[model samples]
Target chain A: MKMIIQPRDERTQPARIIAGYPQTPLRSPKEPLVKRAPTLSELSGPLEVAKRVKLLGGDIAGQGEKQAIGQLIHLRVRVLDEDGAPVGGAVVEMWQANAAGRYIHPNDDDHAPPDPNFYGAARVVTDESGVFELRTVKPGAYPVPTRDGWWRPPHVHFSVFGRVWLARLVTQMYFPGEPLNAQDRILNAVPDAAARDSLVARYIPPGVEPYNALVFEHQIVLRGRAATPAQP
Target chain B: MMIPTGEATIGPFFPPRYVDAGANDLTVFEGRKAKGEAIEIHGRVMQEDGTALENLIVEIWQADAGGIFRHPADPRHAQADPNFLGWGRAATDAQGNYRFKTIRPGAQEGRAPHINFMVMFSGLMRILKTTMFFEDGKDPVLMAVPAARRSLLIAKGNYEFNIRLRGENETPFFDD
Candidate 1:
């Protein structure tokens, strides 16, 4: 049987396009009506220290005998709540293709050879300081079939499971100064350029101490419009 | 008062590598049966155009039969069922079909029996959040929704729910 759903309540609705870009042409014209739930945010709750501890400090991508055959990078990030308080114990999961633009999964039929050393997945918990770090090689750009073969910019897929479902976020971290960011439709789906820019990670120059890898800092704000816009 | 975070698609190519062996069954823990009525929840992940959205990830979290969430934030004094995981994940098959073996979640303050859903797939810019309620419940949120559309949120007999990404009869998604 069919049901005529009501329009979403404005008070509970997020900002359209900018806050929750539907990704037009890509979004379903028959997409379901949005229902605003006052209890939705309560679905997530504080994770246990035991569960949190199990996820801390695991290499996500660089697991090969060699350094994974790409530019070495040291990525650091801080997780924060809406009130600007550091959120400890949140699980940060990351997965991505290797430096050769190939994932270590059977479904990735791109024919790009997977690096044996690159595990391609990692998990960590935000420490008491709300900071987490990962040592990995830069992922290469990969192509997906869109109109005439769309090439996804170099990016790492991130999934943050915060204390509450309201804080749960899944997004891609793009490299700063990547020319393809301008041409990519997924990145451009976000109407606000400033908000879109929040997805890019910036390079930090290696200090004189001679660290072997390039560093990038990307902070994840769980539920806020401040520095990092919350993912819809 | 905090603005909700935006979402991004989980992308295509999320292989079975991420699937934990027992992720699709919430009624069992370490081979022990959970302490609730076992029910089957089945649905299809379809696009607005009635096409199946294969390979999409569907994850669900809900409170146990005692109305207590497995999460630490549950304020109610209910005890959690040791054998109930209260969470499950499944990927849509070639036909965009997914199913879960779970229990009927109990009601809690300001809410009725329901299951929370998170959908992730390629083409989607971000994950979509929604809830499924039993037709028998009297949830204020469900009641507030228009009568005709309320059926969209209610699971029918046989516990079947079909998720439409867009188009006519689109499922009701939440901004929460």
Candidate 2:
């Protein structure tokens, strides 16, 4: 018996290589993607990923005394398969810059000061409803290190592991209404306007949520069809 | 119509503590060591320019030494080794090198002993997916790959599987 994966629809993906991103030209292959039918290796994936890594719950904001200095926001993200069904038990691992746009990583020598309170990495498992809520400070926009004057809009990097390896997806979520979203080479790389809009989270004004932080609602749609029944 | 979310760059800022030092080891489960021949897979992730690509995350999923997977998708899930942790993740060091400690997986579904590999980094905008196999075994899927490129999937002497993102030496990556 053999299991198969739904081949990716290229129109929804960004060009493997982006022009402005200096690393893309060198690292991305000019060759076309190889095609093949998936076997058990592709059908199965890691189970209980949360066990290996600590699940810090939803909040990734400030520690005890000092708080991360940014507009505190409650971001609710839903992880769903493209079939419109909830994807329970999926793991969503995420990381972002501090309110000052400085990452705790040593490579980030950007002038933005680091918030001692903010440890900007977290992982959570989606509930049976396919939703995971996050409480954190809004990440700040940062400039690209390149001489070109490109700056990234406030966004969060997401690594999603669905029920199967074929459903795994890694992407960035942009905040709606940010001017940078329009100019982001990566976001614009998707040819479909609707798909690009899907990457941007919707904002809800404060006072609506019980918490003081502004609310942003986002949904991540992983590639559809975990397995298409084994063929004898 | 179903619309899937688009891809984006991993960017340069992976948290230093993405995973603890123990992430590189997959032989332990609930404090008990797994059963079978323990082996190590080491490799450097290289960018197109031939420079080492640092901070890239390498994750692998494989069946236990008994050729069983704990995942429900596998029919043999129930027989999986209770003490064998089948998943491992490690980040590249400053030298663009990453290593994983685990036993050589048993053949699964009549396929060869292999570890499913995925690469995530700041440079490439999407996940780079591949498989690592031992030199002795022949997987039908690896055979499906072009004859010239099949060598890229096999770990050579010393079990080193260096990954090149591009160029003539690039590894044969599959799209799903």
Candidate 3:
């Protein structure tokens, strides 16, 4: 079979290029290989039923009937494909530390107390319009065991699965106006300031001010540049 | 249209709840066994320094024995196996070893049989995507790879492919 090799466009950077943390050392240099675009065969596959979607709720950190301790926030995300089309039925999974910067997992040895109410994870499927919403508390920043006492800025981790495996994406979402954004190595790894800014969620006002819950809007673009821009 | 968004790592804190009870087994779906030759793909996740990378998550998606995937986008005429989910996700053990129980995927679009893999771990700026081919298959994708590095993409009986994140034996990665 004959193969046509193409050069990678300079505009879109792969994740490995921008992942500049100590844990993830840079990859060794090698000849650039053509990334075969997804063929119809690759597109044909079963979309896993949204079994994890049952965990979706406004209170990720909170247990049944127990609200987590922290500032209340509402998060809304839209999933889109490379064509700038809404990708309905895609799964969006998110995990984050509690307001105190503590995770409920065993590996998280951080001294901060794990909020008993916070489950720390939620999974939901985008609706027909490609949107998923969750009500949760703002997470806190915590120190990591990297060199120089590296502290991870408050952020939410996201895993998105589109129609096929080729569209899978995993990234972190940051809050806008955080002072630590300037110093975070991971966020800074992306050379493009606009791309990095897309990771920050924008605050939106809720209709009822008395409710006092913070609202943030963010969107995830699945594939190529033709898809909706990462951040608008 | 906007530029494609950059990738990010799946940090160390992936919740345990993400793993479903039978996520590692693709053959067994709702008590009905998928039709095909059941095989196991096993390997370890290692860093460039040769240290074991435990707790990493690996997910695989492929076609069924009939060369049909369960996905809605597949335009092929092949019939998808009702009993096959065609997708599975597993995490590496303390020793960085991971395994998946699945059938040999059939060929599609004149291409050789292969399975797609996505690797995620803390510190990964984005998930790593790669494909695994059976040693016996005459896949052009495998043939196009350098002769010396082709072994890194092939799985023999019992199927083992140790992933080296970077370094001398850094596994070849693909663009989306």
Listed per prediction, chain B TM-scores read 0.90, 0.94, 0.91
lDDT of 2 at B87: 81
Candidate 3 per-residue lDDT, tens place, B72-154, comes to 55655347888888888889999999999999888876678888887888767667777888864556566666677778887
On TM-score, the leading prediction is: 2
Per lDDT, what order, best first? 2, 3, 1
Residue by residue across A1-232, what tens digits does model 2's lDDT show? 1223576678888987777888888777655556667776677777678777777667888556767778888888988776666778888888999888888888888789888888888888999989998888888988988859788889998988887777788899999889888788778888888888889999887678746778999999877653443244
After aligning candidate 2 to the native by TM-score, how far in Å is the CA of A40 from where it should be?
Answer: 1.6
Q: What is the TM-score of model 2 when looking only at chain B?
A: 0.94
- Candidates 1 and 3, the one with greater TM-score: 3
Task: Candidate 2: list runs displaced more than 4 Å.
Answer: A1-4, A226-232, B136-138
lDDT of each: 0.69, 0.81, 0.74
Which whole-number lDDT from 0 to 100 does residue B148 have in model 1?
A: 73
Better of 1 and 2 by DockQ: 2
**Which runs in model 1 stand beyond 4 Å of their true positions?**
A1-32, A35-37, A40-57, A61-66, A147-149, A208-210, A224-232, B1-5, B30-33
The best candidate in terms of lDDT: 2
Which scores higher on DockQ, 2 or 3? 2
